[model samples]
Target: MSYSEILSFVQFIHYFTIIIFLTFNITNVLSIYEVGVDYHAFGTNFTETAFLTQYHISNVRSIVLVQLQGIADRGANFVTLDIWFGSEPGKITDEHWLATFPMSAQETTNLNQYAADVASIQSKIDDHRLHLNIALFWLGIADYKIGNLTEGFGSDYLNASEFTARIEKTTDCIITAISNIRCSDGTLLVQTVYLEAEVMIGAKPNQDWFISTHYPRFLNQITVAGFTPAIYFLVDAREEYILDKDYIDPQYPALNGHRCMYWVYRSLNFLKIHQLPFPKRIDFSCYIDRNTSTYANLTYHILNDADAALSVLDAPKSYGIAETYYFIDDTQRKEFGQAFALEALSNPRLSHIRFWTTPDAGGKGIHIAYPFAIEDFLPPLKKISIN
Candidate 1:
């Protein structure tokens, strides 16, 4: 019959098999802390085994990975087939390009293969090992080896209409491929798609084109038909993080790691700002330094601190939840306010701890953290005017 009909039939068979295979449980999938790190623990090259290892060490309920038509090609071809669950290991060979540019109905076979690939991935996530998030493509980054000036080169390098079309096709295929995936705990596992737009570390010509020119257009073009909006959020869209050395790739500013506090914190801030109106999640690629092996250790430490913070029941309540606070560490404390803030944040008893430094403190590496219990020990005070 038709390609869509064939895909539907294949999905029907897959669903039938799952119904026969898995025992239905009545428990609810509880709200899980979605702290996650991308599948970059294996250096420049990515592998499933390495992803599993990183997942375990991260102590997070979610793991992030990408399925490409090809990473280095113009059609944006890169696929993950080897470690997919419910399939023979290495049964479907990896492909560089799922479909060529100027796509046609003949590409239906490619679409079917892509759908199957996503189905396999969903199966693995349904095992409840960890939630899976797929980063569609690195927007704004260019690969010279990929396409021509007319086609606009690689993933983010494409012209507006071309990029949107490609993303629409890819997103549609992935969403259609994986149907409702229920975890053993009975929680529905909807795949999270990350619409990535970021600024890179070092300078490259036309890198900012996607960010400045295309991304705004993208916001309009992206459509969440089957998936929930809560299942998505922007990654590394803030400009300050891109320029900050502390949060960037050592070799290239664009590639970020766990050390890039802004990478996660910014998304968190966005969520807070937007109040997370829809289903949304973001995954971080953490690196302690520039080394790959340190990902697990670094992620563990951060999560451990977060876990500890969650246990606190009583912390001094402060006003101005949105207002900035300054932590003034006059104590020749070597670690200073940063250390002080870290200690307080890690304490389960304390939440809403934000720190800032005044011009005077900034000069001396000291900071002023506020909303502390000044009422308990001090007398009534009069307000002072700067003038």
Candidate 2:
């Protein structure tokens, strides 16, 4: 071939190769990528257990343990129980069916005993190479009922001061437990906790106290203490709370739940903007009936919004993504899981998703599924206005 013709042919081949490479790259990006699944509370119940088994069956890494209750005698593995304040006063009583197994008054008195109990549980978890997490309710600074009236006398308990004290105590116990446990490589166990919204806003506090005094105080306390905590909004997303003009007050920042999320997103975004450490996970616990169209639609919107936010910041989406394969009972498993999965498939950025209900058998339901992959993506800090 002539020299000019040879050069032209080589150039054509180069261009063709580039085009093919680009096409392949684009195709790969569009293909079905199996992200990780996060089963909230892996050991909570048979459903959680089944979900974890399925996660293993599907080869999912990164799971978040939800309210893994009952920490009585399981050793350091049962450390999760040390933080348990009975859900209600009746549950607190030994005579009631719902009553938590009585701990001797001495067991409750010795602060170190609580520490020891937690440490034992942590040790067990570490031995098995399991992850541990805790979820705390944020009852607004008020006294609330513990349980049903039929079971026990309704009593005013856990006001602001008491709740704060409990939180501090719980934090100390968890920290001690975590410190005692050694991972496979001899590293201390990493822990996470959830701060529930109802616990914060249940008292209907004025917007100022709710946001400034309560919310910021809670965040500062947890952050300064060196625990990785995430804001948990357990609201009925299907309800008209978002649309209600009076649902949230603008002056008091923390009282605004929707705004709280926006603020959190911005705060985390600011950390990314400035290259600081911030919580990498977001957990939104919705009480959707699953069978209702309203539940399906509400969850879909929230998931899509979360996906968009994560994509924009290139952060991995966490929580509300997993399928709840296990339930305390199978009453809503099929319906809920199927609905959750359908909504999950529409999002592409999900890294880990789980479907596990809590309380095992008798406790009130704790069902949540995370639908995102848990990949290590270091997001850059960005400063954004919360207003």
Candidate 3:
């Protein structure tokens, strides 16, 4: 065909693809509803009234559960079941509590309870108005108590099969319960799985290496079971966010800065596999020494404060691995005016780097701020690596 014909064909294909994509997305938009919050350890404390009120203003339309109780009676439409694997009925002790893969008899009993919980929750969903989308078993509990994190999964720790079985059992329970519901063919239940296997943050090694190394192994299993992945990255930060004894775990971060900092490193590395949106842009100026006169001096400031620098440098993205750029006003740049400090922000190794000030600030010395940190979490950095 002629060159014009090829161009015309290409344009036609593009528009056709666009039309199909738009239609698919529109259908999804109309169907899917998300509600609920990250019910991490707040499992028992959650009340439908309190929970709904919290997100009512935000218009959240989906639910993500870390624990289950009398939610079914609460009139919830969509529920995301965070099927946890840990402990058994009766007096629970640390030695035998951690449920391993393949599941021991006691562990099986625990899973039975999970199934019962789902039935109860689903009964509520069935009784409530509207449809429901249930994400089965979001891996295990978002804490270190579930497994031997230091050694990682398998042998002495979690077995992929155990997690799979838990999910299977949970799904089976839902299916059976829904079938038994003489109360309706009214509630529409769409079954999907949202899997997550997160590492803890405060132990000696914190199982960081073990969890990271074994992450893909478990994640692949989840996918093979046909589950979608969800983020529990913030769970590591929560020990710091909620200060009460109930939420406070001695093995996790207790300060907001520490929590935010944990996410920075953990997320940066996790981004290598799964891309997520970057969180709101936290200002570098907040952590850096404000009085530093020049860009070179600012560089010294960063070099002097390595921990702070890493926390700022490795800030987590809001969504999966999208490119991000940070803007610095000329005034801030003047701090590093013609020096290595200025180069630090301009490092090509970083994702997004912009050097202009926004009009809203009216060009005042751009004071930097982070989302959670009221104060510095870590001691000043002693050594640094820009890479």
Candidate 4:
């Protein structure tokens, strides 16, 4: 071949090689896993609740049992108990006294007794080599008892050094006991320390400061001291929006009539953007409703948003994941299947959506569906070799 023809042929080969390299590297790829769901509802029937608990234990085995379980399940490897006690019918008084400072000796004794009871349960969990996670929801309990902190307690009361100090003390006691427990791996049984934002700020001034101050301090104390503390966005704001009209309008801009989905989305998005450590588990107290729809929408939106952000950052695949809880029957599952299929097909960033059904009381069941994984679909950089 002539020199010019040979040069043209070489150029064709180089371009072809570059195209093949880009195709292999830039194409969409995902590693999908069959993620298990652990369901927790505060007030389901015993049989129904037991079925749900067993469902989790049978599947994930390393499941984290939360609030409703009276005793930690033998099969679970991680157990979580809420610090707020009022959720249990008999323990309402314990929650009541924990709210005030100048407690009578009886109240203090009752609180400590309840704390000891929790410790006893933790001991059982440790015996089985199960890890433990605690969800702190004092703000929800506080709101349930004291009304809005802004109007009733005022910002000063919420931010009082005395109140915060007491909270720190109670939490410290619980943490100390939990930290002593050990898992099969001989590691501390407690895997995470979680708190609600409302508990930290409670209608105090400068809402972001609630996160900036309390979250960092809590995480630092646990992490620096060699414990893993993950942050969780409390569903309290959504609950408050549903219950109190006055609480809904002024603070959360995302609530619009019956559509507050954006608000939930923004909350999660804010945490993700700030690169806060994503908790492996989450709890949603609200039942299915328009507001719940908003929560689901917000979840998908945040996942998509994360994918976009990761692509821009040129990060690897599978950057983040989120799971949600639901209670639905067979008919409801069919309806959700159709709706989710539509959402999944339309959204390129999403990988898979799965639905789960657990036996409930009276042989009935509840269904939950959520996108279990999210992979970063980034384009590969051009590869050019120099001799």
Candidate 5:
């Protein structure tokens, strides 16, 4: 029989086995609020388990942690698996790349090093009992070790056709990597692959076809491959509250005929130059051939306090502050923390609020010295005196 037939038969048998297993032993697979720190917490002094244990806030912290063996122990069960697939340097191939998994599919002479990198993550999680809900894959951030479609090389493609072929391979590699990295139960340790579907971190590519079509296709392939594609939206609502619009809220600066507010007239409601037609996107079912709604469910990451101001209730599925340290003092943190935690508790959907050691991020000194203030970044509200 052909490989395709064999694979299909194997998949059928696998499904049948699963059905038989479930038929005999049935239980709920519902996921709970995997609330905890990200991979950065491992080495950084941002949040230590002691903080949760030592400083007990209101009842809001009830679900924060009950006990702690480490960052991933007990109540703090969530952790991040930030892997670099370009570890193999230049061993690019359709089947396997030793640089990543190291003889991942073949007999390795260097058995000790084979997949030792990724294997270590699995070992750590198993030891500490962590649940990985995000893939902060530091793509294109490391050294110039690869020349493939992934990492920092994809956007270099001249056109959509070229980008399609290149990104499909990257997606294939990503799929393989996700499949390879599993927990002791033989399930995916890393959920929600951070498919940028836009320019990856530091991947400054020509926006021509990359954004227009290349990225759209990339995310589509990811969904079709039986993975729930995810992207992050770092939104700040402080400006919105002050100006009644966030930059991305189709109002600030203005797009699709949005009103640009310049310090709010301090009072006047900005006006849109033109009211554009609503754009319709492809349905979720079209990608994977399943019955679904026209609504878009997304996962969001709020890195700073500015990001936390937005209404996460809209993205009820998954949304939370990943790493927020802009609080001026302990008072600010306590006040803001309590309010944020309280709101998160009410939201049945879930809000990922991470509390690390508190020294590096929340303790000692934390300020918004990000080199550019929000107002400074805004386009100069030009004056033209049309009278």
Candidate 6:
């Protein structure tokens, strides 16, 4: 594309407060979730809800389970199911814009590109049949936001019980689905699946409730259920990355800055409770573009604090689920201010460097199919290498 075209495209994306184009060396690409048909196994039924509706989960999940079982029986050292959710759900973007320009390309579409991504991944997995590392299962329900964060920005008071319940429900669904996908040798098909969600900003005490109480309980619950899944949170700090200082209102306290330190400190420090071998893990994820100033600094603090927390307690090990969600093309990668930080990132806790939330996935705002936001090429970068 010519410079003028590229510039036009960049400005157009700015029109939507979104941009794309990420090229990276992927260690393990994340698979998209497709809601299959009614699923009934282990004497429980998986049904549709407001967030996720099943189209064909049974056959897909079963095929994936059986494939993983074959791999396990073959004595693979470990297994990782790449699907981030048990049931995939599409999100709505840009209400006010769509309210005006209905004919434009911004018409809201479901996760069409994400579905295609998994379909291809499934084909590749099935074609090999012997080596199965990735299979898709979805988990998402975002109704846990506080006031002004809820739908339509109404005065929805942040109820602590309701807040925890939403996240708890989503976590339970993920665990229930994976725990039931047992191999023929009585082993669970999946050892770990990485799932993502965000805890909307609200009262500090309410956020603390999720961090201290709910996190430990979640840890034990997954361990007891023999489910090891990484629950990751992707925070949205589009305008300014604010670090919460004494119950600030304008910033998110849930897993950001000092709150993230507290989360790491109180999460039982990734150590086994009740002598369980596998501790349930959750990942802290954030977006980093060249635009934000304090993001890289905050990230550095997060990693350092996590290390300090683990070291102070002398925890046996550290969590390897830390990731950065970003999409920058080669041109931007070389010139962007975050390029130095991307190369400088040497956090041992960091694992996956994902190029995430393209227009295909509806991104931060509503979008339809576009040229710049292709997922086939916009896979994640490896943690060790940004080039």
> Roughly what TM-score does model 3 have, to 2 decimal places?
0.33
After superposing all C-alphas onto the true structure, candidate 4 shows an RMSD in angstroms of: 12.5
Model 1 CA deviation exceeding 4 Å by range: 1-31, 34-130, 138-159, 179-188, 197-208, 211-223, 226-282, 290-387
For model 6, the stretches where C-alpha displacement exceeds 4 angstroms are 1-54, 57-173, 182-205, 210-217, 229-282, 291-305, 308-310, 313-323, 328-330, 333-348, 358-387
Stretches of model 4 off by over 4 angstroms after superposition: 1-77, 85-129, 140-159, 197-206, 234-302, 309-323, 328-387
lDDT measured at residue 268 in model 5 versus the true structure, 0 to 100:
15
Q: Residue-wise lDDT of candidate 2 within 173-214, one digit each (tens)?
A: 544434454445554444455443323232333322333334
lDDT, candidates in the order shown: 0.31, 0.37, 0.32, 0.37, 0.33, 0.34
Q: What value of lDDT does candidate 3 attain over all alpha carbons?
A: 0.32
Find the 10 residues in a row with the least total lDDT in model 6.
33-42
Q: Whole-model lDDT, candidate 6?
A: 0.34
Per-residue alpha-carbon lDDT of candidate 1 for residues 1-387, written as tens digits (9 for 90 to 100): 999999999999999887664322101101111112222222223322223223333321132224211111111111212111111112342322222332223233433333343333431212323333444333222332245457675644566566545545544544554444444455433444444422231233443343333333333333333433222222232223322334443432223433333333333333334433222222232112213323223323444322222113111121100112222433322223223233223332212111222222222443322122221111111001100
lDDT of 5: 0.33
Clashes by residue pair, model 4: 261-294, 328-367
Reference-based lDDT, residue 176, model 4: 55
Can you write out model 4's per-residue Cα lDDT over 173-224, one digit (the tens) per residue? 5555555555445666555566552222333333444455456567667776
Cand. 2 Cα-lDDT: 0.37
Task: Give the lDDT of residue 20 in candidate 5.
Answer: 89
Candidate with better lDDT, 1 vs 6: 6
**Backbone clashes per model, in order?**
24, 52, 31, 2, 6, 13
lDDT of 5 by residue, 78-108 (tens): 5443233333334444321112321133222
In TM-score terms, candidate 4 sits at 0.44
The digit string of per-residue lDDT tens for model 6 on 1-387 reads: 999999999989876553232221222122211001111121111121111122134543444344334332322223222322221123444221111111111111111221222222322222311211222222222222223334311123434554455446655555554455444455654444433233322322234334444555666666687755444443333323334434332322333344444434344333333232222333444444324555456555555545544455554334432333323444443232243234233332443233322232223543221122222222223212212
- How big is the positional error of residue 242 in model 5, measured in Å on the Cα after superposition? 5.4
